[model samples]
Target: MRYGMAIDTKKCVGCSDCVVACQTENNVPHGYSRDWIAETVEGTYPDLAMEIRSERCNHCDNTPCVRTCPTGASHVTEGGIVKVTHEECIGCGACIESCPYDARYFHPDGYVDKCTFCDHRVKNGQDPACVSVCPTHCMYFGDLDDPNSEVSKKVATRKTKVLAPEAGTKPQIFYLI
Candidate 1:
């Protein structure tokens, strides 16, 4: 099944709670983050509209990072989650350059790092760290292939947008605006 996430922009409050939770759950290093809040302000003065989005790896189906990895360190799993095998990574930086979202980062340990969609928790039948800790309950994660899943239902009913659709990555994450 294809796993994915649906985030409601209207419900997000620009709080960085998801960011902190992700770092804590994944043991992300200092001066780095697996996810972050992106603030976009439109218009001017009293007419200004602000959109706060929690952003992370899109986990694209046609992942450029995976394709650029020489050692097969970056690969897609059976469930369609993109993962990097640190042991096999050569730290060549090819994957970093190819990523459209600039999501992957060079780790101090000599490897590329990015979001794993909390595979550890998902394998244990739990939601991803960010989703579990979000106070607004704006995030939904599940198999997109399953019509019964909340993520799938949201995509079907809501006016959602995927980041950089022209990039041709076919990102799994959908934003409900």
Candidate 2:
């Protein structure tokens, strides 16, 4: 279904609530995160504008991690979610190196780990944990292929950007700025 996300920068407050929620919901290891907050400040003092965004694996249509993995552990599901099968991962670090977003990390359990777009929760008819617990309601997740989906609508109507677009990953996540 080409699942994706749209995050409104105007509504985000850099609270990292999404990060915490994702970690809790995914059972992420201590000191490791499935999501993180990125802040960018422009100008100085009175003329300054700061942007705070929640960042994670983009679940790219041309996912480099998947292409680089030797064991097929990193693969894209039918619904367009890029997921890593921990049991099949050998922690060769090739996937981590291939990702331009620096999203995947070697886990303590000797496997690679990164955001899965919460495909488990999504399959159960629930929003991704990061999107659900956002205090400002800044995050929206749904099918990018469905024009009526909130995420698709926001992307169509708002000024949005994807990180490292030049890398040609064709990331599914859109940041509305």
Quote the positional error of residue 93 for candidate 2 in Å. 0.3
For lDDT, the strongest prediction is 1
For model 1, the superposed segments whose C-alpha errors exceed 4 Å read none
Report the C-alpha displacement of residue 146, candidate 2, in angstroms.
Answer: 0.5
Residue-by-residue lDDT tens digits, candidate 2, 15-127: 99999998899889999998999999999789999999999999999988899899999999977899889899989999999999899888898999999888888889999
Model 2: runs farther than 4 Å from truth?
A: none
lDDT of each: 0.93, 0.92
Compared with the true structure, what per-residue lDDT tens digits does model 1 show for residues 40-120? 999989999988899999999999988888999999987899999999998999998998889989988899999999999
For candidate 1, give the lDDT of residue 32: 98
What does the lDDT come to for candidate 1? 0.93
TM-score of 2: 0.97
